[model samples]
Every structure is written in structure tokens, then in C-alpha cells.
Target: MASVVWYVCLAGLLVAVSGQIVDDCVLVGGEKKSDVDVAILAKLAPLKNKRFEAKVEEGSDTYVYTFVVCGRVITNNTSTNEGLLQTKVNSKDSSVIGRINETHVISGSDWILLSYRGGDKYDSHCGSEPRTAMIMISCTKNTLADGFMVIKEERSKSTECFYLFEMDSSVACPPEESHLSAGSILLIVFAVLVALYLIGGFVYQRFVVGAKGMEQFPNITFWQEFGNLVADGCDFVCRSRPRSADTAYRGVGDDQLAEEPEERDDHLLPM
Candidate 1:
């Protein structure tokens, strides 16, 4: 049993150390990074070609947000707007809000957040820093309506700007894992241990001890004795008749008692 458990543990350790690639969204080769559930990302894969649009009015300017998942942002409006994330369109003029620098799926406290880093920098008035985008994808059970909304643009103290967006979809939900119960695991281990014991015992008894037939079994003598004891106990308990009192105990005036006095007659006379 101990040896079987050791082998099972060793196999599990090897699998964990191999670190086979399970998903692109999962974080690897990092110390403090947590693994992002790839199921959510996989659910969003179908939306890669589908672009989500939202319009938000702030002060005097209106902003239009268009984005996709696991791919570049393509609005199909013009060739110049191929990889742009957000576009600031006002009454008279239109400008780029953010350009795609890089995109990654990162793990949040309870959900997944997609980051779109724009490479294009803004003017000196906006701190001359590249605008970034964050899309918060939340899991939803409502399959009928998928919510898509733009939260707002946040301007930080460092003059850097961020476009915040939110999405509620069923794809962001974590996948359910199929796991074996404790009883199932224990039964498997016990079966493996029994197989190993039987095989090892057969090999040793057949070759090393030169045993034949049923004697090749391990602890055959002990098993045979145990079987006999069990059979005897069953017979005693299930007997139909009981011994008579005459045979159960010797009578005080039996013929053997009379013969015993005659056999000790010499000793009685001498003593």
C-alpha cells in the first residue's frame, strides 16, 4: 500500500513539474503571477471577429469605442483606423484616442480583464503618454441579453488617460472540472495495491522458493489456517443437537470411580 501510494505521488509530481501548456491566457514562468482560467478566454474566442461598439458623451466631446477579443481592432471604416482602439469624434473634428500597442488577458481578483496597451502617444497637454484600455469582462448567467457598456474615460494624476469598458457575457465564467471522489480514489489505490501484491508474491514463490500449484500464493499457510478456524466456528454455532448430560460430565458413582479406588488399594494400605 505504501509503495503504491509513493508511485502515485511521484507520477503526480512529474505531471505538475512538466508544466505542459494548457492555455495562452494562463500565466507561466512567473513567481507572483496567478494562472488565468483559459475557459473564459476560450468562450471569448468566438467574439474575435465580432466587434463590440459603444458611444459615451463626456462634456462637449463624444467618444466611440470599438474593440475585439484575441485579435486586432478593425472598425472597417478606413485603412487608417485598422488597429486603433478608441476614436474621439466630435462635431467638427475626429482624432485617435488610443492605438493598439499590445494585448493580453490577465487574471483579476474574481474574473478576467483584457488589457489593450496603445502605442500611440497623446499631446503634451495630456502628458504625452500613450493611452491604455481596460475591458472588464464579467460572467453572467443571463444567456438572453449580453450587456456591453462603456464606463468612462479616467484621467490620472500623472496625466495618463485610460478608457474603461465593461462586458457581461457567459464566456467569462469558469469551467467546471471533473474530479474523482475520495471513495473512488481510495478504491483505485486499493485495487492497484492488491494487484501488485499478488503479482509480486506469485513471482517470488514460483521462482525463488520453487513452490508448486496453490502453494505459490503468498501467506498460503496463514490463509489455510484462518479458513479452517472459520469453518470450525460456523459448524459449532450451527449444530442441530447438543450433547447429553451423561456424556457431558462424569457421574460421581461411575464404574471408573470404583476401579480407581481398587487401583490405589496398595497405596492406601501402605500410607
Candidate 2:
């Protein structure tokens, strides 16, 4: 029991002596990290104490919030000064994710917003070892078609490099990328084309195939033959009486033609 007390006292002394800035803090959870940095959260003297800039309204009354950690909430007060924060690098929690309002393409560093988890749970658990770190694998907010989303970027050490991922209320990526591709559109077009081809073939078969196997096309000879056939059929049907004279004459001529034969030239006999 005496040893436990000493250990607790020693921990308190170490925390007090370290008296560091936001960069020195350890990450607990909720935010991702990366070796490849997306932006410089601070160009100079980063992760240190500062008065809450009006541009970075971190949900505090006035310029009261302490400091900005890369992927975690602002620790309200960890320094000797009222609005000052201590630096820490081993973060356990992440910054808050806020909405991006612009429609234009946004890229490179210099992002728009900052956010993180706050409260007792974060303060107690953050900045510890074995907590490990995560990368910002993606922040797909800029890619969304709806033109609205909230996201944040953070850094973590793994594989000797940083990675990037996302955390947010909404809109980093659409539910599916299949809608963004041409596959669905191509399939619809192909189906419509096939239907048209089948319909055209059916229409051609029905309209072009007459009582004859293949209907004769509308050329000069075809029209003339068609006219003759129609006239002959009409005359035959309207005949007032049987004309045996013409019929008998035509039959006798046809029989004579059939009976007539050409004289044979016997080349073998002549030789």
C-alpha cells in the first residue's frame, strides 16, 4: 500500500514536470493518423497553447479553449496560463468532424475545418501507450455528389509512415461507386438496342413475306407481272360463257408443239 501511494505520487510529479504542449499528448481513440501529412496544423511552434482564434471556434466561450491537437479534442487547460494548452503527441481521441460547404474542388493541405472528442472520458484515456495510432485512410467528402460532408485529417505512426482516414457525421463517400461508372448506363443502352433489332426483324418478316414465299419487290417487271395476273384473274371470273373455240385452239396448238421433234444429225453414220 505504501508502494502504491509512492507510485501514484511519482506519476503526478512526472505529469507536472513534463508540463508539455498539445503535440506531446498521446492519442487514445476515434481519430486516425498518417505519416504522410496532409496539412501543417501549425507552420511554427505547432501543438502549443494559444488563445482560441475566432477563425477556429472550438466550442468554447471566448478565446478560452487551450490548444489544438492534430487528431484529438482541445484540452481545455493544461498550462499555467488560462487559455494555454500543453503539447502532446501520443493522442487517444480525435478532433471533431465538420461540414465542408464549398462546391469547388478542394485539394492539397490547408483544409477547412477542425473537430475532436471532448469531456472526461477523453482526458483520462488519451495520450497513453499501447493505445496505438491509426491513419486517415480516406476523407471522401470532396468526392461526394451531394456537395455536402464533414471530415477531419490526423497523423499516426505505423510502418514508419503516416496514413490518412476519415471520421464524421456524414458525406465522405457515396453508398456505392457503381452509380458513378458507365456500366449501368451501357447495360441499359445495349438492352434497348437488342430490343430494337428483334422488333425490326419481326416487322420485316411480316410485311415483306406475301402469299408467295418471298414477296416480289416493287420494280418495273414486278409491277407489270402483277398487273397481268390481276387482269387475267378478273377476266376468268367474269366470263359470261365458256369460250370453247379459243380454249380448243390453244390446246390443239400446244399438242402439235409437243408432238413436233427436231431432225437428229447422226455424226457417227456420216463419218
Candidate 3:
């Protein structure tokens, strides 16, 4: 039983360490399309009742954007749950645009992740360039949602480039208050003390009382003194009134007093 308890404690410690690691590094996002990425900074914007700006950058071969969104989440008063801050690159023309929603639903303390990939379908034409888009969404709290669209221009392999788009959201969920009551804590402490007292009492009764009883009889141990007392009483009674061969033999030397009684009677009568 003790080994089992130790193992359980070790497992809990390992889980806590692992959770800390993941929380520090991995960006929270939805698991399916249409599902919001909770890790993005933009997700938390609404929770603060403020609008945050999105930063966009265009590279020679790819474009990148950073944004913040706000949502409800469980956190300390000073901190907020930064939602998904994603970076995506269009493999074709390098054209990129990023957008993220500011609002989200409060579903416990879990997070979400949303992902997307380019598809072959053309959404529309931008200027003279034909645009196609694809999207994928997933949630950490539950099932993934429907895919959202992202529009990108088509281009030849020689001119093909990548476009990167990033969306960040923040959500804050209030921390839960402790459920333990003062009375409950007191009761637990009282129970533990009572158990210890009972154990101590039992040990004292078995060892201390028994040792004192043995000390009362100096000549013999307690058990040996009890046995000798019983034996001496039996011998005195059997010798005083013999009923069997063993008793008769024990009384043989004492029978000389019986003969003296007969001799005294003869002397007192006419003889």
C-alpha cells in the first residue's frame, strides 16, 4: 500500500512538470478549421475590452503578420491567455494577409488550435491574378470546427513565392476558488491526532502494563509465578487427603502421625 501511494505521488509530480513544459512553449490553437486558436494574442483583446493592432511584414519570398485577439480564460489577475499567433506562407505568389477574431466562448480552462492549407479552388481574381484559398481549424477543448477560407494569387513555379499570415488571440478564464472549508480542515487534523493517540494507548497497554505485571513478582516471571502458585495449591490439598497412588506416596512419611493417635488411645483405655 505504501509503495502504491509513492508511485501515485511520483506520477502526479511528473504530470505537473510535463504540463508546465507544454504551457511554457507550445502555442495554444484550435484542432480543426473554423475553431479558433486560443494561443493567439488577438483572442484576448476582447476580454480586455480593447482592440489590439496587427503587425504585418512582407519578405522577398514570403509575407508574415502578427496580431492579437481577446477571449475569456482562466488566469491570475495580472495575466491573460494569449491566443494563437500563427504565421502562414503562400507557396505561390508570396501575397499574405492576416486576420483574427476578438471574441470566444468560455469552455472551462482548455485551449484551441486552428490550421489551414492552400487549396486548388479559386475564390476570385485579384486584379489580373486568380486567387485560391484553403483553411483548417481545431480546438484544444473539444472537436475541430469547419474550415475557413484564405485567398491567395496563382503564379508560375519560376515566380512562385510563399505568403505568411499570423493570427494571435488571448482569453482569460477566472481561477476557481478553493473548495476546502475551515471546519473540514479542523476535522481532518482532529482525526489524525485521535488515530495517533489510539495507537499509542494500544502500545502502552500491551508493553508497559505487561512489563509492570511481570516486575510485581521478583522470584519468577509473571507467567512462571502464576504456574507455581497453581502447582503448590494442588500439592497441599492432595497430600492432606490422599485419593490416588501419587497422593498416597506424597503422604507416606506423614502417616506416622496416624499410628501415634492409635497408640495414645490404647494407653488411655484399660490395658
The most accurate candidate by TM-score is 1
How many pairs collide in each candidate, listed in order? Answer: 0, 51, 60
Runs off by more than 4 Å, candidate 1? 1-43, 75-84, 88-101, 177-271
* lDDT tens digits, residue span 121-207, model 1: 766645877766678888775551256688876765467577677887665554455699999999999999999999999999999
- Strongest candidate by lDDT: 1
lDDT of 2 by residue, 1-271 (tens): 6534443454344435433422333222313322111211221123233222211223542221222233223344632111212222344433222111100111232232232222212223234211211212123444321222112222243322211222321222222335445887889899999788666655665576542333333243566789999999999999987776554334445657676578887865955
* lDDT (Cα atoms) of all candidates against the true structure: 0.59, 0.32, 0.36
On lDDT, who's better, 1 or 3? 1
Report the error of model 1 at residue 241, Å: 33
Q: Give the clashing pairs for model 1.
A: none
TM-score of 1: 0.45
Which segments of candidate 2 are over 4 A away from where they belong? 1-25, 28-33, 37-47, 53-108, 120-271
Q: How many backbone clashes does candidate 3 have?
A: 60
Off by over 4 Å in 3: 1-16, 19-177, 211-271
